[model samples]
Target chain A: MYVAVKGGERAIENAHRLLAHARRGDQSVPEVTLDQISEQLGLAVDRVMSEGSLYDRELAALAIKQARGDLIEAIFLVRAFRATLPRFGASEPVDTGAMRVQRRVSSTFKDIPGGQILGPTFDYTHRLLDPTLAEGFVPEAPATAEASTAATPRVTDILGRDGLIEPSPQAEAGASVGDLTREPLNFPADRDLRLQNLARGDEGFLLAMGYSTQRGYGRNHPFAGEIRFGEVEVEFAAEDVGFAVPLGAIELTECQMVNQFKGSATEAPSFTRGYGLAFGQSERKTMSMALVDRALRARELGEEALAPAQDEEFVMSHSDNVQATGFVEHLKLPHYVDFQSELGLLRKLRQEFAEANEAEPMKEAAE
Target chain B: MAVLAHAEAGEIAARLRSLALPDHQDLREPENGLVMLRGRIGGDGAPFNLGEATVSRAAVRLASGEVGFGYTLGRGREKARLIALCDALVQSRDFGAAVERDVIAPLREQLLARRRKVAAETAATKVDFYTMVRGEG
Candidate 1:
């Protein structure tokens, strides 16, 4: 008794029109501008930029508007737009040591060099909504202090100096880094590729995986050695110029997690490093990224890869929201023809079953 | 020769754009687009996408058959085309000196002045920390 619905094209056209109206929402009311989203909903834009793998604040804001504030949808839009752009050249790696840090903190030490600057964080804020903000009342600004220009060294370096942490291996100069977008991810991905994937991976997925690690699935005892947010200058080499030239700066959030590693037969026990860096003030994402990154390094550290978080293939393949959403949402497309065939087979089997049951009773009576 | 910084090149291009450039054939018309910015941890470790930035680029061939290219951040199509023209003109022995004197020098001065102003502003925010030894075990 299934009736195939028609007018799909007409319905879709009308749906889009309705969506446009919904996006505007109450024509009498003032519309939200791109600047409003970019300035006020900045964290949302940051997350979209971080996960979307795009950085234009204007584009991120527009995408947010177009997606009706569905962050994942905005991220999908950015990712799709990113596919059309041409690649120039990769910039030289940014110098985090020389970063003009706006915020720098460490959980490992009581007081570290450059001191703990808790710049513009919601860490201590109570979960209370202020009604005055809705009434458009601006609050008094916090007291400003003279900015310190001291070099904020990495907290891991302090542990490294004492031979307490496992020495990090250095990448060779002029070594080519892999681009996950351009190439398919292969098994046993190196640290570079793993980090690249995690940087643009879905924040929620990474957060859950990171939570699993902390909840004793992967069980890497980690200390937030350093979480720093700031701007760093981008430099690229021009062909005519034999040396690197500085481009304008971009904002960044970097996290270095120091995790405990027990002694193996060949080496002594020491702390290991798990690093994460993203486009903006993505504090939660950076922290989660650090944890998940550490969990993924279980195999590299010669530890047992027993948990789902430790399984590189599983985590990497399913972490991209764009791919996940597309495949999952594809089910909503027309399945009428395929399902109808299945319905016909089901009916035939049922009729045959009824006929066989009827014949069995007769045969029994006859016997 | 000291290589010009990206900002410096950008500034020169901007100045050149305001003044306009000699007539040239559009080898590649100015197109505004986006480019993904990538970064790394600790300057040498794992790589990550920093963000996307707006960029415009164009190419031109001068009447003298010298080809030039220009690129700049943000949607400045005329700026990009002007830069391409300047680049081509710089390649010409006849026009290189005049372009450098008229365009590049003024931009460099402006850029340097801006840098000095920024440094002064930063200096105003400097803080000096003082420490004293306390009795300890």
Candidate 2:
């Protein structure tokens, strides 16, 4: 009865074998290819890439397949792999203004320049599932337009020209950007570091934080001034050529939120801004990021930090799902030795207490 | 360059093979391997492992000693070899223009057409929202 649970290696080995068998399921059915997952289960791949902070679709698809389609597990797998990679030279900050925008919309204005292009969204679609799609379905292609070189003027630019909104950060050429990978996060982080943390933070966690802010916690009158999804060219400095060369283009989602700032006693009323950018078509993630980003800026804005989201230390420290999952799942591991020591101490304390009670009764009888 | 990045390595290889370039040797044999993709929180935040990606890389040298390297996203040995050959040809003084004109130019047009097709399809479903100025009047 007291025998300790031993020989876990064999069990573990067998369990792995069973897992492999289960992963393959039926022998007759064709195995799911990485391309199939990358293209067909594209949204899942996007989520893994977004959360995993990696953009390589093939790798994300592979991770998804290995993790049995578990997004978080796939993210963990990706994160582990990412830890081992070497860093290449950083590219120049992408120009979102020049983005070949596929979907650009604004809730703040009824209409704006380049007009609202709701490229592809499920915002107005019914949630009903079509059972017929189980057989097969192919989406019809859409109409196209010739690519325009004209830059899309930001909505904020209109207000900025009049000095109505707070002045945006001036682009400082060759400014030293902090690398989160190389440095441990220190609290009271600068805007750059905080935004970085939020970008890679768990989507669900950020969504909840964002939701809390909207429910009057750190209430800000956020108007999604603009949300855009499209491809932007990444450029790297070509030292030999004396100018940056366009390395490639990657899809990105950018959101700019404008909030009405009712001026405090010392400051004048003006519009404030919160920005979010993420890999791929991550509208919800990007939008939620914008809200949280704004909420976290309470201290900078001279506003009271009265909300959970406003506490930068709290938000950044526990935002990572991998860290959270590890700490939680660690409880399942063997703690028998630690438990046994506690049991021994409890027994000794009980024995001493019993003897003291017996001695007190004898002394009372003698007296 | 963007076309190469987005295009499948196998497709690139097929195109390169069809070019029928002069004899070349593998400077570095096409090696199928994995590259770990790293990520950062918020972009500038602390780094975390995103995952490993399968990749194939090769380097080729033309008879004239012009060397070229090719790195592709997945395990496509033939694709890698072809890309490497194209890379070498691109560096060759005599063949560079021809390669760019025949290969890259066509690839770019094809990629653009594909993108336009998708954009057109998506535009068909575009929705416009409007609001009424209520009361005050």
Candidate 3:
């Protein structure tokens, strides 16, 4: 009953040949280089890096090219390639406070310590397509204002000073958080694990889940306290090294959502926070992730878990697009024996019903 | 070290050519790997794994017994090896000052200049919002 189907080798080879032929459409046109993909199609590259959960731009670009611009497929390729590499060790927790701020904005306040920078944003751009872009239009650079003299502080820190926001829940002094890559994710995961899942989770999935909460699925109305995009240095301490060495800078997008938390019987009412951090300038991804992060905290904050976004198991399990795609696409594989058994049973049932009907008619006629 | 890791491979390699250096051998051959990146829960809370980054690290030992280690982000094995050699040279007595004058000082300057350029360009995009008074019109 469990037979292995073999010999699709010829068809598979033909399909691959067709694929390579199609991948390079219009052979006369100059082939898209890795530099072009990495530089021009940069946002696509960024998404792959963030969702793929790998931090190499060149690798992400290569994956994108190989997948023929299918971003999820590119992500799958990245995850596969990462499996073959050696893992050195975990880095020291990155310091977001000292980020060389390229873009920082606070939606809740009119003014923040570091003045708002709308660096290369699509926010204010009109939805209308620009025809000039196809012909390579370059705009003149804008004039500069003096850099901020005030000390840049994260909005959470400013709020935390007044005890306006509930202080971040402290882990035991030396408690280590779970890494999903190393250990299997069990239900009732900690905040750290949940954050890790969402950070690399599908952008569209989180966006939809977050949107559901806004439509009163499990409303935790959030105000975007701050969103910052910039680069920060990663420090890793190798074996036998007394000091941690800098492993170079990586860009990150971080979002902090401030949600109102009505107090419990003993605890005082204060604002709560949800945090999102991702690999590159994935602004939308980070914002959606932050929104969903707050919604999922219903159980922790003693609120009723009434929504899909609030369900930790549902969100965490389905958030990974790579796994979801695999399970869904596995339907294409052979299920011949299982289907044949079902077919046989249905046919037998129909035949028995027909025979019973014939005998009942004959008995009536004879009578 | 931060600047060195961030600097281009060509910039680093060219700096190494001028200095007359003793022979150095690899203690650890340059190898590509991944480093799991971690981030705090909030900006300042408990730590969590964010992702991993590609890195290449190498170590070199000079004839004089001075040991050097190099690490760089991404799969630049040659850059990692060159960095190791520079690290060892900077540690050694006779070549320390020369390596400092050639590599460290110049890379640091380049890093500063690049940072300044980004800061300036970002500053150009700084937004100053204005609100219309309803009664004025």
TM-score for chain A, candidates 1 onward in order: 0.94, 0.90, 0.96
lDDT winner between 2 and 3, please give it: 3
Off by over 4 Å in 2: A1-6, A26-29, A138-151, A171-174, A238-245, A262-268, A352-367, B20-88, B128-137
For each candidate, what TM-score against the reference?
0.81, 0.84, 0.97
- List clashing residue pairs in candidate 3: none
- Candidate 1: where is the Cα deviation over 4 Å? A1-7, A172-175, A240-243, B1-29, B33-36, B41-43, B46-54, B58-137
User: Model 1, range B1-137, lDDT digits (tens) per residue?
Assistant: 11122344456655556544566798988886765566665334555545566666677898879987766555567666666777788898878887788776766676567545543444343234356668743
lDDT per residue for candidate 2 within B1-137, as digits (tens), equals 54675566656766676566888899878776544333333332333333234455677889899877665555576666677677789888888887788778888888888777766655654555655689744
- Distance (Å) between predicted and true CA of B34, model 1? 5.3
Q: Highest DockQ: give the candidate number.
A: 3
Chain B TM-score in each of the candidates: 0.80, 0.82, 0.94
Q: How many residue pairs clash in each candidate?
A: 2, 20, 0
The candidate that achieves the highest TM-score relative to the unseen native structure: 3
Reproduced native contacts, each prediction: 0.26, 0.14, 0.79
Better of 1 and 3 by TM-score: 3
Q: Chain A only: give the TM-score of model 1.
A: 0.94
- Using DockQ, rank the candidates from best to worst: 3, 1, 2
- Candidate 3, lDDT over the whole model: 0.90
TM-score of chain A of 2: 0.90
Worst 10 residues of 3 chain B by lDDT: B15-24
